[model samples]
Every structure is written in structure tokens, then in C-alpha cells.
Target: MTEPAFLVLTALVDEPRHGYGVVREVEELSGGRVRLKIGTLYGVLDRLVADGLVELDREEIARGRLRRYYRLTEDGASALEAEAARLAANARSATERLAARSGRAKALGGLA
Candidate 1:
């Protein structure tokens, strides 16, 4: 998954939050990289909810026109954790491979 989706999932990792709250949390977490548009948010949310990553929780605070709460499922947490690990491992492996190649090239008096 992309960083925005990951950030959104990570935002819900702590507690249930409404749509706007989620957008804010994701922005905070990603340092303003992932701006969750209303339509985009719902689209991602629908997929995540359908995939059992998130669920509708209690409505703690609702404005007249907006949905105001959702929590991550246990499955969602697990999935997020797994994806994070996978991405980390992939990054490490790629770094190591590039480092080795760079070393080899440098030793051979060649550009990487």
C-alpha cells in the first residue's frame, strides 16, 4: 500500500475517529503528505472496511452532516503491522543490495 493509505490506517490504530478527525490525524502522522479528500477518504474507507481492516464504531460526536466515528478492527491492526514490517524489510534489502553494488563499482573504479 502507498504511504497515504498506510498513514490513514496508522491514524486509526490508536482509537476510533471520525472522517474529519482521520484526515487531520493522517496529515499529522505523515507530516502533511496525505491529505484525505472526502471522496477519497470514503473510497479508501469503504475498501478497508470491506477488507475487515476497519469497522464502524460508536458515534461519540456527530455534526449535523458528517459521520463522526470509526475504529480499527483487530484484523486491521494486524494487517497494518504486517504491511509495515514487509515494507521495512523490503527497504532494508534494497538498501543493502544497492550498497553492495556501489561498493563493487567503487572498488572497480566505476560509477554506481
Candidate 2:
């Protein structure tokens, strides 16, 4: 999954959210690293809906505009879990290699 898709699924894990809500949650989840534009948010939402990973939970109108809320599907949760595990494994591999490199550097009088 792409980072935006992963984050969007993760954002919907707890509760259904409207477009703006998803955008805010994604930004917070990514520690401000992923600020999603309105158009991009809808694009991801549309793709997820088409993929059966997310569904339209409801629609409401507030302030004279329609607000569509989205929720994660079972498949989405599973996919997110798998993606998270893959990312964790990749991180661990990098950490281990970096530690080994640091050890070598130390042994070589900090040449690295």
C-alpha cells in the first residue's frame, strides 16, 4: 500500500470520519509528515472504496455542504496490519545493519 493509503486506512481504524477529519487524522498519525490535500484525500477515498478496503459509512450535511464519512473494512484492517509488519521488518533490518556498521567504524577508530 502507498503511504497515503496506509495512513488513510489507519485513520479510519477507530471510527468513521469525513474528508476533513480523515485529512486531520492522517496528518496527526504521520506526525505532520503527510498533509493531504482535499483532492488527494478524495482520490484515496475513492480508490479505497473501489478496492473494498473502505466504505461509505454515511453522509451528512452541515453548513450547507455534504459530508461523506468513511470507515475501514475488515480487509482494510488486515491489509494495514500486514503493511505495518512489513515496514517494521524493513526498519529492523536497517537498524541492525546500521548498528553493525557503527560497530565496525568504532573498531576502525571511527573511520566511518
Candidate 3:
């Protein structure tokens, strides 16, 4: 429901991924701004899984390591879209307010 959650969900939108994959994808998408710690990733994943947004979709053994893949459910996809729309709306409102303020300052003979 927040930035990290949204980022994680968005990363998972294209395909199912393990925890480390999700973390790496999010970091890359954010230009290395949102590097998630292991603990943080698991915590968020647990909450998402519990809420039925994400599920334990599959497990595979590769290179002798256990990799658990998570996939977003239909509800999860819908939720992510809703959150994205909400954030976009907020951003648009803020931009409008800033533009109005700038216009006021210019009208008052101040800097643009």
C-alpha cells in the first residue's frame, strides 16, 4: 500500500520471482534508490502473502539452492493498479498547486 509495496508489486507484474529477484528488480527500477534489505523484503512479502495479494506460486531448486517464487494474484494486480492511480492523482494535484503558486509569485512581481 506504500512506495515499497507498490514498487515490489510493480516489479512482480511481469513475471513471478523469488525474493532476491524482486529486490533486485525494484532496486533497478528505482535506479538503486530502493535497495531493500533481506528482512524488509521478507516482512513485506509476508504481509502481501497474508493479504492474498501475493501467493507462494512455485518452488524450484537451482544450483543447489531453494528458490521460492511468488506471483501476484488477480486481486493483487487490481490493487496495484488502484494504488498507482491514487499516487498519480496525488502527484497531479501537487503539480497543479505548485503551478498556481508560481503564477501567483510571478503576478506579484516576484521570481518565476
Candidate 4:
């Protein structure tokens, strides 16, 4: 899954959220690394809806604006879990290799 898609799915893990809510949650989840615009947010939502990963939970009118809330499906949660695991494994592999390289360099008095 793309980073945006993964973050979107993760944002919906706790509860349904409107478009703006999802945007904020995603930004927070990514530690401000991701700031989704309105257009991009909808595009990702549309794709997730089409893929059966997200569904419309409800619609509400707040301050004369319609808020369409979205929730993650079971499949979406599973997909997110798998993606997270994959990313973690990749990170671990890189960290291990970097540590080994550092150890070698240290043993070689910073020459390796």
C-alpha cells in the first residue's frame, strides 16, 4: 500500500472520520510528515471506497456543511496490519545492517 493509503487506513482504525478529520489524523499519525490536501484526501478516499477497504459510515451537517464520515473495513485493517509489519521488518533489516557496518568500522579504527 502507498504511504497515503496506509496512513488513511490507520487514521480510520479507531473510528469514522470526516474528510478534514482524516486529514488531520493522518498528519498527526505521520508526525507531520504527511499533510494531505483536500483534493488528494478525496482521491484516496474514493479509491479506498472502490477497493472495499473503506465505507461510508454516516453523513452529518455541521455549520451548514455536509461531513461524510468514513470507516475502515475489516479487510482494510488487515491490510494495514500487514503493511505495518512489512515496513517494520524492512526497517529492522536496515538498522541491523547499519549496526553491523558501524561495528566493523569501529573494530577497524574507523577505516572500514
Taking all chains together, the TM-score of candidate 3 against the true structure is 0.91
Q: Which segments of candidate 1 are over 4 A away from where they belong? A: 61-66, 105-112
Candidate 4 residue pairs that clash: none
Task: List clashing residue pairs in candidate 3.
Answer: none
By TM-score, the better pick of 1 and 2 is: 2
C-alpha lDDT score of every prediction, in listed order: 0.86, 0.94, 0.93, 0.94
Candidate 4 Cα deviation (angstroms), residue 11: 0.7
Give the alpha carbon lDDT tens digit for every residue of 1-112 in model 3: 8788888899899999998999999999899999999999999999998899999989999899999999999999999999989989999999999999988988888543
For residues 1-112, what per-residue lDDT tens digits would candidate 2 score against the true structure? 8899999999999999999999999999999999999899889888999999999999999999998899999988998999999999999999999999988889899554
Best by TM-score: 4
lDDT of 1 by residue, 1-112 (tens): 7666688789998889898899999989878877889999988888888998899987663556656588899998998999999999999999999999998988888643
Deviating ranges (above 4 Å) for candidate 2: 110-112
The list of candidate 3 runs beyond 4 A from truth reads: 110-112
TM agreement with the true structure for every prediction: 0.80, 0.92, 0.91, 0.94
Cα misplacement distance, residue 91 of candidate 4 (Å): 0.5
RMSD of 3: 2.1
> How well does candidate 1 score on lDDT at residue 6?
80
